[model samples]
Every structure is written in C-alpha cells, then in structure tokens.
Target: MTVPGYRNVPAQEWDPAAPADPAEAEEFLRLCYTEVSRLGPVEPRLAVVRAQIAATGTYVHTTDELVWGARVAWRNASRCIGRLYWRSLTVLDRRRVHTADEIFRLLVRHLQVAGGGSAIRPVISIFAPARPGRPYARVWNEQLIRYAGYRTEEGVVGDPRYVPFTDAMRAMGWPGRGGPFDVLPIVVEVPGESPRLFELPEKAVVEVPIAHPELGWFERLGLRWHAVPAISNMRLRIGGVDYPLAPFNGWYMGTEIGARNLADPDRYNLLPVVAHGLGLDTSHEATLWRDRALVELNRAVLWSFHRAGMKISDHHTESERFLAHMRNEEKAGRPVPADWTWIVPPMSGGATPVFHRYYHEADQRPNFYLDSEAAALARGAGVRPALAAAPLAA
Candidate 1:
C-alpha cells in the first residue's frame, strides 16, 4: 500500500468523486515499490516503502479531511524548496555534505511528515535568506538553532544574513535587495480617518494642528492639536497596529555651529501629516513638526518633504504639488534654494524639548509656495489663499 496523501495522481484539480481504476492503482503501487528499490534495496528490500505503509497504517485514506489533508500531498515538495535554498548557501562547510540534490531529498523526508508544502512557502518567503552564507548543512544547523532558541538580541546578532533583515525589510514592502544603502522611508496608510491611541491619561482629547494652509483639510475633518518635541522621529498607530515609523536616520533644523551641518537625530515630533504623508512603505518617515513654540499652537515643518517648496520630477504621475512648485518658480525666475542642509539641534527637556545635535539647514533651490515669496507676491502680502479650495492635481 502507498502512504495516504503523500503521493497522488496529478490532475487539473482534485475531485472527491474521482475513483481511479484498480489497474491504474496497481501500477501506481508498483511504481512506489520500484522507487524505494534504488535506495540500497537488494532482494531483501525489494519494496520497503509499500511494506512499511502496510504495517504502519499510514495509508488508510485517499483524501484528507479539511485543508490539512488537501495540503499533505505537497509536503515533500516544500522541504525540497527549503533544502534548495539551504544547499545554495556558499558560506557553509562543503566537505561534510553529500550532493546538493541528495541533501534536498533527505531534507524533504524530514519536512514531509507534517503539512509540508503548505507550510514551506510562507516560511521561506518570510524567513529564507535573500543571500546564502555557506554551502553545507551548517547553514541549516544555525537556522534551526536560532529558531529553536531565540538568540538574536542575546549579543549573538547572528550572521547578518538576509532572513532577519528582510523580515524587518518586508514590513516596508521594499523587497529590493542591496541596490544601495539609501535613506530609509516609512509610510503609514490610514483609511477614512487617522488612527488613534488606545489609552490617554484621563482620556484627554489630542489635537494635531493644521499649520500649512494647504492642509486645512485636516481641520475640516476633526483632528486636534498637541505639543511635542521637535527632534523626534515619527511614531504612529495605523489600522489598530502600533507602527514605529522613525527615520532610519534623523536630522535637525538648527544647531550651535553654523545651523546647517547634518547631525544624526532620533525619532521625534510624532504626528500624522494630512492625507499627503500616509500609506507609504519605504523606510523613510515624515512627521509634522511645528516650528513655532506656543502654549497651544505653533509653526511646523514636515521633515520628509521638508523641501516642501522645491520641485520634484514633473514626469511623475502622482507629482502634483511638486510640479506646481516648479511651474510657479519658473514664472518667477528667482530660483528658490535648490539645496537643503538640516541645521540646529532639537531642544531638550524644557517647556520645549528639541535635540540640537540633529539640526540641519539645506539650501532651497526653487521655493514656490503661495505663502512663500511666490505666494506672497502672487496673491499679495499676508493674504493666505484657501488651501482647502485647491484640489490635488489629476
């Protein structure tokens, strides 16, 4: 008898009513016996597999009960995939191993006993190394050891392999492997309304201000204002899941030196911007940090597109505000600052806490805001245009 669910006839799809002819079943049984015969099976082990199944009752059913049964058929294949990756590692010791194909066969045997195929893809895609370290079984040994025992932060930062990094990297949906160590971007997406906090001391209402006239859409909704440190990175909650969306690296706006040197800062000034800064998966985080220091309200700067006045590519499909800035600047011909240098440190622990170490000030290339010089000159002095009245470009 063949082990139940381990091997089945290949069909376009599974059908419970399908009954294969007895002759075909007999031929399938002969095939299974012939397969086990090659593995050092002399006359004595002519058909070790079928006899083993006969004695073990492993072949009692034709189809599985629920999803697990439907999945058992693919278990052997899953382990092969796992071994395929494991054997590909160039860093592992190659002297002790057999052929890569044989190693895969043994690996498959060990994994197939459970819901093999169904479990492998998620594990591999989520955990398999984007880069292999070695070419031997040691790779599997290390992985199993760490997985069996949690040792990542125990000072055993483990082999900087692609699995762990990619796991964190997967959160950003940027599966892009090793192009360049570029700046990290974090994108948060909220639907209908901004995500909220679960427990506030005394359940106080939190108000996030809409500083830019361009973002009055936030106030038109129901967002409130709250004062926070300016040197911090963005830490927000979206879809009921708490997300720590900080700049992989942080910069400040002003410092003691000259107020434009790049200083590494921590996550600060955590607040959601208007609909503009939501739903991005890059490692970069953009927060709204008001620039003014007031008891109730103040001016803020969005650190991500801190170049709020500069012009991005006009060729982009989603490039609306960016292109508008360019168009307005070209009309003025003054050429806003094309460069930026974050300066100044965020004040620390006081009525206002900003870390001065990370302050930066970059030169502006072509600043174009209605509130900016162009905006001031276009509409006239101190006359703010209705930001809510403007529509995002088509």
Candidate 2:
C-alpha cells in the first residue's frame, strides 16, 4: 500500500473482520486517553476507559474524545489541503443510530445542517463503530450528493462516472426518472439485512446554478452542483475503533467542481464543449484551448458560488492557508504528512507554492481511509457474508 515517493507508508487493513493488532490497538487507546485528559477532566473516565479496554480490547470515547478524535483525524488527513479550519468541524454524534432508515434520516439532517443555505458548514455524523463481533452499519455512496447516471441507447446519460453505481441501484429495484440531474438515492447496508435505497427529498438538497459573471452563454449550459461534498464511505478509525458509517463534510474547493468534476474526461468533460461555445480554436492543443477553457470554467464556478452566497475557496487562498497550517504544526513539533499529488491544487499546480515542496510521506492514525469492502458494495457487487457478521466486542 505504499504510494510512490512515500517511504515506509503502510497500507491500512480494510477488512472489517480482520483481527485487531493488540499492540497497535493499545498504543492508539493510550494516545486517545492522553488527548482526552488534556482536553478536559477525564481522570475518572480514564478508569472506565481502561477497564473497557481490558475487557474488550477496545475503549469507548467520551463525547469530548469523539469530537477531538474527529477533528484531529481531519488535521491528520494528508490528502486534504483544506484542513486549515479543522477546528471548525461540527460532529453529530450518531453512534447510537443503528437502523438503515434512521441512518438515512440523519443523513438528510446532515445535509440540511451543512448545506445551511450555502453558508456551508463542516460536519461529520459518526455512527456506531464495529465492535469485535458485530458488523457496523455502512453507506454505499461515495458522497451524499451525487447524480444518477443512466445507460441509454445513445450512450451514458447524466454522469458517466456514476454508471456502475446507477446500474447497481437499478438492480436493487430503484428505477430513477432517467434524467441528467436525477439525484441518486442513498443505499444503506445493515447487518443481516438486504441493502436498501433511500431517496433524498428535494427540499434537503441545495444546488447552485452555474453561470459566469460575464459569459451569458455559460448559463445556456445549465450546469449546477450540490453545495456540500459529504463523503459518506470513508472509514473513520479512531483509537482502534472503526466507524464504517461516519460521513463527514467540508466546504467545497472551487477546483473540485470546476477543474475535476466538470472538466475530467471521464466526468462531464465540458472543456471541449466550453471551448466550442467560446469560439476557441479546438483545432490543436498548441492553441491552449483546454487551458483557456479551464480558466473560464473555474471562474464560472467561483462566480456562481459567490453569487449564490455559498461557501467556496479559491485555490490561491486555500494554498496559503495550508502553508500557514504547516507552519503552525511545525511550531508545535508535529510532523505533517501530506500527499503532494493531492496537496497541490488541481489547476495551476506548478504555479502554487505547495507544488514546489516535498511533504512527509508517513500517514497518521485517526485518519479517513477507503475500505475495499465498502467500495465493492457501492459498485453493486453481491454482499460478502463476512461483511454481514456483527463485530464482536471484546
């Protein structure tokens, strides 16, 4: 699981049923309790935590610990350059939520709270952790907000990137309206039950209609995007406890929507279309048609979000804030692990300060990671029996 240029980075185990490493688990619990004590009066709770660990090989976190763990996880998220405001994240402690229907309802509430009229706030709704014997609840969506992709006689309809998910949804008896902007229903998998799809109500979603400040023609494109990107599938490992249903969010970075989602060839791939609309000579790459179109597209995204009164950060300001974060971490004697490929802005990579530097390749604990099992389920694969077993709490 080592990425290129990163030395000594080990891939995290993704299997939910894999036995926990006792030594590593013990170290993680020690760090958790130490952090909790530093944040508040947890001396009494420490005894309970230790006893729980002794009996179960894992410990329960107080509400304060959960909040701290979630926030620190964000700070330790090497792939996210937007961690400058990690302290601002809001944690919705939903660890008590168990059923798929309740999970869907809370997800709706998460969208409502985070998407708060484009004043977009960072939030994470943490569900139950996988105990030693019990399988925890899991959501199958990459993000809470995504459009349905449909297969058609003409070609792929809507977003091509979602075809697999869309096909999977169809197999689950979800027949969408088959439109370009159809919102996909969320699929929640509970232990010992069939995975179910829950449709998102229109009132819960906030989308910004994209338009350029000056380019009237851009409005004709009818492009739009959801306000918040609440990643739902990444497993949150805190103090040896794995919460498979923790969905967290942050305000959008303009490049995420403009330079990648709308511009990547496998996605909407609007660069060529936008170039033609702008009358740019697409005859050759030498003309820099793609580059020129990208700028305007990014401009539209920024302008649209601003006009809609939504929270979005331009790459320049975010990069500067990231450097400030790095300095603060260094001053505190904390090592900052970053993935250069992700730390650098998607557009104008070399032009940004982050692009010129090398980052520590080591990964930190209490971080978000992709789970292969969750990914396979999201792709509509048949449920693996092992994944359905309830996690056994020691």
Candidate 3:
C-alpha cells in the first residue's frame, strides 16, 4: 500500500506481503554495527538476518539493534528541531504485547515513565512488528494526551481539531465530561478485535495551568496544556521492518503550544481572548495587536510550564540546539537531512537562526512515518471496509 509523504517529503509505498529488502537490511546492519563499535561485527548478524528473511519474509531486531534503530530514527527525523538529544532517547521494547488491554496498560506506563517527574524524557515504546500479510495493532489517537472538542451551540468547546475524533469516541461509548480541557481516552485496536477506549488516569496526565508572569488576570482564563507531547500514531520503520504500534514522545517546544496550538484560528483561538484581556485595540490588523497577544500567550505558556517545573524549551533555544546537532553530524562525516519548512519555528521565523539557512531534504530510512491510513484513523475516521479487508503496510 502507498504510505503518503509528510508535507514536502516524498511518499514511500510499502507492500505488507512483500519480503524485506535484503539490501536495506544489510545496509542498516552495517551502519549500526560500524557506528557502535561495541556491537562487534555485522557479518554474522547479516547472515542470520538473510536466513531469517529467506525463511519468513522478515527478520527480528535484537534488543541492542532495536534500541539503536530507534535512536537513529530520531536522529533522522527531518522535522524535529531537538535532534541534539536523540542519543538520550529511552527505547522500551514491547514486541511481545498484542492484546488491547495489555497495550493500554503499557501505554499508561509509557506516559508515567516519560513524564513522571519534573523533567520529561524522550521515550518510545516499540510493539510487535507486522508479519507479512497480517493485520497489525495500533492506537488511533494522534497524541497520547489531547483535549476533547465538543461542537456546541456556541462553538467548539475544546480543541477543534479533535471534534470528529471526539464524535467517534462518543459513538464508541465514551461518555465525555464536555469540559474545555477533558483528556481524551486512548483508542487501541488489535488485529482481529474491535477498537477499545481506555481513559488515562489523572495521575498519568501532567498538566500545567497557564498563567502570564506579568498579567495577573491571565490565570483567570483557565487555559492549560499537557506537559508531555507523546505522539501515538506514527509508525516506526527500522532495518526494513515496520512496527505499527510504536508510540514516542519528547518534551514540548513552547511555540508548539503557544504559536500553533493556542494561536491558530481553528484551535483554541486564544489570541483574540488574550488581546481583549490586554485591552489592545483590535480595530485594525496593522496595529499588530495579534502579534502582541501572540507573544504574551507564548510567554504565558513558557512561564506556566516553568512555574510547574515541567520540562519545556523555547523556540530560540531549540533552534540553536538544532544547528549544533547539524554541526556535530557534519563533524562525524554524516549528512544532516532536514526539511527547511519544519526546521523553522512557527512563530518569529525571521528572528530564529534556522530560518536564514537551507537544509538538505532527503527521505532517510530508519525514521518514523505517518501513514495515510493512520492519519485518517487519528481523525476518528473509523476503519474503512476496503482498508480493513486489505490492510496497508508501513
């Protein structure tokens, strides 16, 4: 099946029934072993992988190989600006997990492991890889922690992006609280069984109440956001193998919450509210009232997260770290493939150093990918009949 590309990246069509490409496997093994000197030699591992693929169409990754593959995938993520900490990622191998109940329990554990303390760490839980011509399991939520959006007579009560998903959840028997910041349930679907909804415990979700450092009235708005940004739907590809149920997370970049999630018209749309609170003249767009409100909203997000002792990075700091990552990779004689559009921060593009330069754009392997089917599922589009009958591969 054809897996659509993310943004400007080219699409990669993968056939689930097709055998793993021997060349891709060899290249990945060679690279992995060569880079990690302690891994010893690749020849023995290569022979074993070749024989395994010849016998079963795919090869399993050893624990060390799986961990290194996940770390390399983060390093190859073209859109991520926090690649500097790729090596520090915590990879949780959950390949033995299959049932929805077990998956849900582990998912909650994943959240607790990643965001349990004040400092959030990068974590990825890799489940069983898809066998050739077999249906795989996956989570339907775009992120592990997202607020539900209900369409009301007034307007969208929560995040508008999730209204359709919320509707789908309700259809599947989820009794939502109908509040502005109600955390959505985790939808886990196993191979043959129907999708199941598991609500996250209050202890599993770490939230920060947004309040501006200067504006005393800002806390009255009751705006808040989850501390960890755990993306649950993306497929993880490594060494010609696909793991459909791998969910990974990193700490928040302030602009992600401030400039896009909160400021976007379709999202919380909080700029106007903040502007009105600031008493800025909204008479004309030229007055830069929106810009001023956006800055304050971002400030409130950063300050609130900091006050809550939550790990978060400002766009400026992240941009600088990305450049440092590029330099480190270059010194190691490796090309840093990056998408310019995603590398630049959402707000204050010109002010950031990443906006001024060009980056090499390439579809690198051993990277996380968002398949079209997975994206649709995250949007609450229940499994299509055609896709269910003939499942797509990552």
Q: Pick the candidate with the highest lDDT.
A: 3
Superior candidate under TM-score, 1 versus 3: 3
- Number of the predicted model whose TM-score against the real structure is largest: 3
TM-score of each: 0.15, 0.91, 0.95
For residues 34-116, what per-residue lDDT tens digits would candidate 1 score against the true structure?
53444343333324424534454222211111112112111212101111121121111112223333333322222232113
User: Candidate 1: lDDT over CA atoms?
Assistant: 0.22
lDDT (10s digit) by residue, model 2, range 158-263: 8888888887776666777888878887888788777777888888889999999998999999899988899999888876778888999999899999999999
**What lDDT tens digits, residue by residue, belong to model 3 across residues 117-175?**
99899999999998899999999999999999999999999999999998887777777
Q: Sorted on TM-score, highest at the top, how do the candidates line up?
A: 3, 2, 1
Model 2 regions lying over 4 Å from their true place: 1-10, 18-47, 382-394
What local lDDT does model 3 show for residue 11? 65
Q: Deviation in angstroms for 247 in model 1?
A: 40
* Model 1 clash number: 72
Which 10 residues in a row give candidate 2 its minimum summed lDDT? Answer: 385-394
